[model samples]
Target: MDTSTGATVAHRSWRSRRLDPERSLGLRLTLTVVAAFLVLVPFTLLALLVLGAWPPLLRLDASIAGSFHGYARDHPAWVGLMTVWTHVCGPGPLRVAAVVVVVWLVRRGAPRLAVWVVVTMVAGGLLGALLKLLVGRDRPDLLDPVARAAGYSFPSGHALNATLAAGVLLLVFLPFVRYSGRARVALWTAALLVTVVTGLSRIALGVHWTSDVVGGWVLGVAVVASTSAAFTTWRSGSGRPSAHPLREGVEPELADQRPEGGRA
Candidate 1:
């Protein structure tokens, strides 16, 4: 009888400690941000579509597409280079690489980072595909040295993949990598530049409208932000151990500290 009473008391005590509110603010905040982002992004995109904003957007797309079309028509060598580069940076291969990297991170015990990467990729890819289907915008039809692509082109996949990849990489490395501030800045700069160039490549290849690329970038950024917030919450709730050795053996004083590193 005494043993049973003692066990019940201990269980209640553990529950109280686990549910302590002060340590969970970060988690609450992160979840709130994620919820807000999920609501806002789709609404904004729908508003833009419903307001008939595509005409002006498409005109801008054509102007940018025209320059690439002209350049590709005149410079066969440059066109060939761009064609190859575009294929190299296309959604299929980049997404595969992203998956491999994410799996590697998970195996390395950075499961939170891995989850964020995979979530961002899947969310961005699905969202982009849905938007493309709904918009159903035609690609620029013009003289091009490179082979033409066919599909309902809105929200360029290249741009989506580039932005998501850059965003995921930055999130994964920034908090974890032991790098100088200048190096971190340089790394981010390079990532941003790569993302921009990837988006531009779609326009250059005459495979996507300018609006498509811009929309993709916007969606990608939103996905990154929202997914990061959700990941932060999940990591917090799971009671994972600290990666920092100095913090080893210290009982988690906050919600962000999870036992077993939040592994399922």
Candidate 2:
């Protein structure tokens, strides 16, 4: 009986320690590092394969690109729709949207959050550009092409920007959606939909290989995870409440403001 009582007490103690925000910060940061590594390693391997022109990857890229082009030729309407989706959700427009969000955040008195948004998007964009240049991969060469994009194609710019934009906006508005509810579900669904569809639009238009889209996704995710970890560290050091960005969003205080927060 005594042993049973002691075991119960120890379990409760351990659970409490795990729940302690101050104690868990290190673990959270470690997990972020591991996640970033997992994301980057795959991207690096893909870039290497592109550079070396690995046969298996090249065969796969050609097969997929050819199939997509075949379908694109038959379906003019679908091709047109994909073209519009690609352009509307492309990097340029998404960056503009991110800029608008930044302005909104600053006006709402969350300059830090605004800065985080800018840094995340800009850094992701610049990194994507750098990787594209370094990889120096060419776009899928399709005869009777349904769409066209001019750039190195190891990582689709549209995919990277859409992913970064989705991640930034999702984190920004997550708090406002109350963490859990239909609103939260809708926000996540929209972000995911935009990210995925933008990537697919690139493939469907016969402009990017499957590997290019995948690389973009991996790199974009790495950037977001890295920046989010840095922001969380800053919050902890500044004596803010513990942030579980995956759960409560990056800046919960954004949604917890009073009327005065909106005033000059």
Candidate 3:
């Protein structure tokens, strides 16, 4: 009887500690890191490994890549269209977009978010570049290539860049979405569609293996999700006092973000 009573008490105590907002906030961040960086990143790499180093999978990858290239060859018009989004969501464009967004955020009294945006975009791009070099996979070859790209190719840069650009923009603007109706839903849907199309365009253009695009998506989502987790932790940990529209408010994030914050 005493043992049973002790077990129940311990369980409740543990639950209380785990559910504490302060600790729970950190816990959520940890989980996000595990899921994105540890799990998904590794899985993506392993798939690339199989696709790159394994003979059987290599044959399959080549077949699909060739088929995609052939389709692009037959449809020149589509190639032009795909190129439009690919260029818009490419590394250069994404960097420019990041700078523009950050400048706007800073001007709008959201300096913290501006900093976060820069860090996420720059850091994510650097990480993706490192992974591509480490993997050192080659791009698809064609006798009559529809388009040309230069770089190591285990993970598609276009796909990764597109996703990060779309994702970061979506999240940074989410706080200001101002409504829960079709406007918000449509915004998200459009972002998602653009990301997907950009990734597929790389495949169709004969520049990347299907696995490469999949890996890019995984890596991109991981980077964005990790950034989001950090933001959430900051908000829940040091969030400031505010009267929310619903009378329930998440904290305002870093002390530096507060209007009268001691630290900038």
lDDT of each: 0.68, 0.86, 0.73
TM-score of each: 0.72, 0.88, 0.80
Report the C-alpha lDDT of model 1 over 98-206, residue by residue, as the tens digit.
Answer: 8887776766665656666787899889988887788776777776336677777777778888888877766665543333667667667876986888888888777
Give the C-alpha miss distance for residue 107 in model 2, angstroms: 0.7
**Candidates in order: C-alpha RMSD to true structure:** 9.3, 5.8, 5.4
Q: Give per-residue CA lDDT, model 2, range 35-87, as digits (tens).
A: 78888898898888888999999999899988888988999999989998988
lDDT of 3 by residue, 120-204 (tens): 7887789889988888888888888988889898678888888888877777655444355565676688779878998998988
Best prediction by TM-score: 2
Weakest 10 consecutive residues, lDDT, candidate 3?
242-251
Residue 260: error of model 3 in Å?
15
**Where in model 3 is the C-alpha error above 4 Å?**
1-16, 19-23, 37-52, 241-264
Query: How displaced is residue 120 in candidate 3, in Å?
Result: 1.0
User: Which of the two, 1 or 3, has more TM-score?
Assistant: 3
Let me know the TM-score candidate 1 reaches against the reference structure: 0.72
